[model samples]
Target: MRLEAVGRRYRARGPWVLRGIDLDVPEGALLRVEGGNGSGKSTLLRLLAGIDVPTTGRITGRPRTAYVPERFAATLPFDAAGYLVHMGRVHGLCGRQAAARTEEWLERFGITGFAGTALDRLSKGTAQKVAVAQALLAEPELLVLDEAWAGLDTAARALLDEAVTERVAAGGTAVYVDHDPRRLAEAVPRRHRVAAGRLTDGPGGADEMARVVIEAEGTGEPPAALPPHSWTAGPAAGAPGLLRIRVPADRADAALRALLDADPPWHIRAVRSTGGTSPSGAVR
Candidate 1:
């Protein structure tokens, strides 16, 4: 899907929550949205999912889409399986196929035991599993997840991760918003941020570009556990045991994790992100 100069607001003349959002979300692209709270990140996701329309500018090329919000209303009247089956039909699935797919996803998310349980009785984690499962039932061409991992357990979170990987591998477009910068850090997804009423591309530079400055104090060189290419560091000029490392933002989390996990853990003084700036959230 494509958005050109898009903008939105609640009242006809209320403050615009998002503006000038020009983005091209093609098939097979996994994009991550970031920013502080009330930054209009959720508004952008809603627009992309067709839950709301842009009051200004235009959006086009939307495809068969599915969305899982941060919170799912688990107080519905139907049981887990029945609700999924109903949603499946809404997504153009026939009864038998929908039922089969519901079973498949329920079991995949490790929520099959609760499949027959009423939605209102399921636990938060189980309800989250159901939310994710419902969105995947149709194998949608576009999947939007807005903090869908908030209440999931580790295993179920991993299942959702795998589900997203599979969806993108099948040429679908997935856009998500999450508070954790490292939610899918390993994927090295296209990054975008919502801030100050504008949507802008996240940090980016050449592979050799250093986006994170890691200052630490360690006894020796980096352990063999860390890949050589992940970072480059040297002892602080005159300060013994002090090391300064520069790493790419995409690998910063893993790099930091590895550093802290070493035998004699390195004491991290500070880790600061260093990169380009987005002016007024224009897509560049």
Candidate 2:
């Protein structure tokens, strides 16, 4: 999806909330939008989600979209499961499919016990879970989250993070706004900031940082001084004792040195860049 010189304002002559904006929402991409309060971040998200129309310019190639706004209506009449099923149907799922997805997301969000409870009867956090679940149930091509993590519990927040990653990995696009800078930090995602009704690239823009993935293993624990901004995870399925580390391209050498210098030393299996060929100094 793409936005070309998009602009928005409330009234015929009202001051613009966003203006002269151009953006590309590519498939399989994770994008973060940031800004101070009243800086029009939400407006841009709304436009991306097709919740609000642009007052000027054109937006093209929008796909099946879902949005979770900053606030959800907790007073809706339907029970949680019923509301989600209804939303799934609205997103074009069949009845049985909708019900199945409703159950799936309820369990994923750890809210299966609240399935039969009325929306208005749920607590704020549970209500937020419902809001998030509704959006995810559809597996939308475009997901727009406006502080969708605010009221979620820690577990739920983590689940949402995984869900967003899954969506992007599945060839969907996710555009979100969150107050936490550490959100999806491991992805090293593309970022943009809104200020004075305009959008600009943020720090760590996609082109500015390339990532390197290192696969290694050792009996001892990892080094205490791993490179900054790097993250480690357990190896892929069937690879016990293996560790996967991702670091910025520039720090790949430092991370490899740290792992190799550790007690008992880590054995390097592979090192490759996420965006192209193996980086320089990669070990096999």
Q: TM-scores of all models?
A: 0.72, 0.76
Q: Which prediction has the highest lDDT against the true structure? A: 2
lDDT of 1 by residue, 131-162 (tens): 88889999899999999999999898887887
lDDT of 2 by residue, 86-114 (tens): 99999999999999999999998888999
Model 1 lowest lDDT segment of ten? 275-284
- Per-prediction CA RMSD (Å): 12.5, 5.6
Number of the predicted model whose TM-score against the real structure is largest: 2
Clashes of each: 0, 0
The local lDDT score (0 to 100) that residue 94 gets in candidate 2 is 98
Off by over 4 Å in 2: 209-284
Q: Global lDDT for candidate 1?
A: 0.77
RMSD, candidate 2, Å: 5.6
Residue 229 shift from truth in candidate 1, angstroms: 21
In Å, residue 247's CA in model 1 sits off its true spot by 21
